[model samples]
Target: MLVQKNVPLQGLNSFHIVARAQALAHITSEADVKSLLADPAWASEPKFVLGGGSNIVLTGDVKPLVLKVEVLGRQVVGETAKAVIVEAGAGEDWHAFVAWTLAQGLPGLENMALIPGTVGAAPVQNIGAYGVELQDRFESLDAIDLQTGETFTLNAGQCAFGYRDSVFKHSSSGKQDGGYSPIGLKDRALILRVRFALPKPWKPVLGYADIDKKMAEHCTDQPTAQQLFDWVCEVRHAKLPDPAVIGNAGSFFKNPTVSPEQCTDIIGRDPKVVYYPLPDGSFKLAAGWLIDACGWRGKSVGMAGVYEKQALVLVNRGSVDGPDGATGGEVMTLAKAIQTSVYERFGILLEPEPVVV
Candidate 1:
């Protein structure tokens, strides 16, 4: 394990915003994490865990020890007639893991082909793309409780996953009290590894509207797992900006779910409004459509602008000097504007998916 002080976090995050970490450590093993927590230098210091740093916006410098989980490995732990249980280290790149699963002929994760982040952070947000979510294949995960320096396992049910949220994000308080609070500087835990049960016979899903249309146009009657993966990658690449060139964190907000009555009311007013009926009987409205209808796409406030192709994504096109040059605040302002506009137009509220820190 290597510990560095005053590390620059500009390149660590996908937003490409500059921030400084008071102390940073790369933990290769659980023992290193335990030892670091026991050190007096970090006894009272706040702790933060980082994976790929894909789904976060750093408002300013972090005053805690940012422990980067570097543990790596993947193994087939269990198998059944219907599914195969695959376990991966938390530090494994999320897209790499998806590709590895596709190589092994696993069926479930093909729809989430090119998502950015680490395997560990996948369950943290119950990440979903196209028509699939992590909870669809999640079995369990292991995480270290920073408070007690103890390792704990969380099953799918224990994860408390909602739309882009989980226990690792919603649990814990700054001080020890029975009050609900956001996981902030004083209360955060580290994800260690995740276990996923992928289907064996590979039942490919072409559920999302865009995916279905693309497959239909390509004459794909029954697409294979590899075909689905390839198509998803192509679609995402065509629509979303490559964070490597343009700074972004994928979709900035989640599609707001509304009741059936609310959906009917909204559709009654505007017949062209697009919405998908979820399996749970809720209606998932098109957040991008709402934002685009409000004339936000390609609109820039200062350094941040909505991606012209995908209204859900906010890009940082400002100077790359430092915090002053970053457009984190500009993105938030646009997001808030979209949220307020959607609410005023349709009485539906849009919620941001990324962790705004």
Candidate 2:
């Protein structure tokens, strides 16, 4: 039930934006949350769960009570005919968890190696990379209701996973249409732990261009899970700046999806537009290509700058540990400008991926 006041948050978030939490608390276990809820001091206050802090942008000093998730555990929970159930605490580093899975001989999560953030935060964004997504490996999850303090479990379907989105991203208050809830958990729930169903018969997820290049370079068609993990890490390191060094929140925008006709129109204008056909008969335009096409690479707004190597990444050009770091406002300003340019050029509004606080 201990609460710290005026906690510095620049180190917590990947963007390294200068900010602070008015009050912050750590939840290392479910009992901690229960205890906090029972206290009159915090029971009725609005709360925001902070995990690895890799997927958020702090715009200013956070006014809500920041509950920094620090729960920890990892084990093989059970086994099924087709897969094995593995559980990890919400606060566990996502990349480390992936490595742990591989160390235990699990293969499905290898394709998602090196993705920043915590395991609990993964479902909120339905985090994906290369050719695989969290939904593909998710079995179920246990969460606590912030308002009621009741623990509950939900299966994959309840998550309502979409590209870099899930029920967790929406607010609980939404209009009811066709008997379906539009607003989801949002700030009402705190994910305590996540269970993944790793495949029994291991197989590598291939065909991604960067991965293919690795395969071609190695001259090995049949790659192991460890190899895939190494290559994914290599590819990511090459494209994205380390948040520990140059502050960043990975890809700044979601690759916008459009109708086939819309893709055709864009292609007619610029044949070099990078896109991929979805199984749903839609096309996903590379947001990086659009940003690059608009000539935003290496551009800056204040201390915020677009990565010289990848237009998809927005970086903090100033010192992270000092007073000269980029503010969340500057980051958002740059992001909005890029969005405006991409929309004007390609007739598509690129959505930002990071959660803006």
lDDT of each: 0.82, 0.91
lDDT of candidate 2 over 190-280, digit per residue (tens): 9999999999898888888999999999999999999999999999998889999999999999999999999999999999999999999
| Candidate 1 per-residue lDDT over residues 177-261, each given as its tens digit | 4422334312466778899989767777767777788778878878888888888999899999988888888998888899999
State the TM-score for model 2.
0.97
Regions of candidate 2 where Cα sits further than 4 Å from its true position: 173-183
Clashing pairs in 1: none
Which residues of candidate 1, in runs, are more than 4 Å off? 173-186, 319-324
Lowest lDDT block of 10, candidate 1 = 177-186
